[model samples]
Target: MARTTTPLTNTQVKQSKPTDKRQKLSDGGGLQLWISPNGSKSWMLDYIHPITKKRLSMSFGIYPAVSLADARKKRAEAKELIANGIDPKEHREDQSRLQELTNSHTLQTVASDWFEIKKSKVAETTSKSLWRNFDKHLFPKLGHRPIDKFNPKRSSALKLSFDIGI
Candidate 1:
């Protein structure tokens, strides 16, 4: 027969004390509170990787900062990701990378890159005048926007803004 784990309460969690070695207090469903000998407490979730069938541990966050309730919610979210055959850690890293790419590809950054090549090909005065127009008109309204968010409707709206002196 499989042994059952009793779910932990907030009081039990709060009253836990660190020992000479690391300790894990289970809250059932693979959620555990890890207490280090140094008195640090953090939440951890144990799960089997969908593809590998190997057990893995993922850190939720620190105690107090991530309450028992919050840790349980994260555990549910991680289990959902695992059920869909996606590793939560990899998903998180991919999201971080995508956000970094999106942030780096803002309108002003792309425009500056194009302007560098244009400067080398055009006469100095023409290049300066072109950049001046971009700086004065487009940058103020759309410079910080991500390139991926642009659409035909928004593009035309921007053109209309220039036409109407907005």
Candidate 2:
């Protein structure tokens, strides 16, 4: 028979004190609060990786900052991802990288990089004129937008220019 664990309460969590050895307080469902000998407390979840069939531990965050309720919520979400055969850690990392890329690759930033290469291959005066045209006409309208958000069909300036053969 499998042993059952009693769910932890907020009062019990708050009353827990650090000991000479590291202590883990279980809240059931693999959610635990670890109290280090140094008196730092943090939330952790132990789960078996769906693919590797190996046990893995994932940290949620520190105590007080991450309340008992919040830690439980994150545990539920992590379990849900595992049920879908996705590694929560990898998903989190991919999300962070995507956000960084999205923030860095705005339309003006990409255009500036393209212009730098164009400058090396074209005449200085030709490059200057072309850049000036874009700086004045395009940058003001859509330069702040991310590259992924740009739509040629939605841009009136691009549509008008294209329609008139510019």
Model 2 steric clash pairs: none
Model 1 misplaced regions, further than 4 Å: 129-145, 149-166
Look at candidate 1 and tell me the lDDT of residue 39. Answer: 91
lDDT (Cα, tens digit) per residue for candidate 1, span 1-166: 7579999999999999999999999998899999999998999998898999999998999999999999999999999999999998778789999999998898789889988987998889988987898899888998999978887475974566458542
RMSD of 1: 3.6
For model 1, how many clashes? 0
TM-scores of all models? Answer: 0.76, 0.71
Residue pairs in candidate 1 whose N, alpha carbon or C atoms collide under 3 angstroms: none
* Tens-digit lDDT string for candidate 2 (16-80): 99999999999889999999999899999999988998998989999999999999999999999
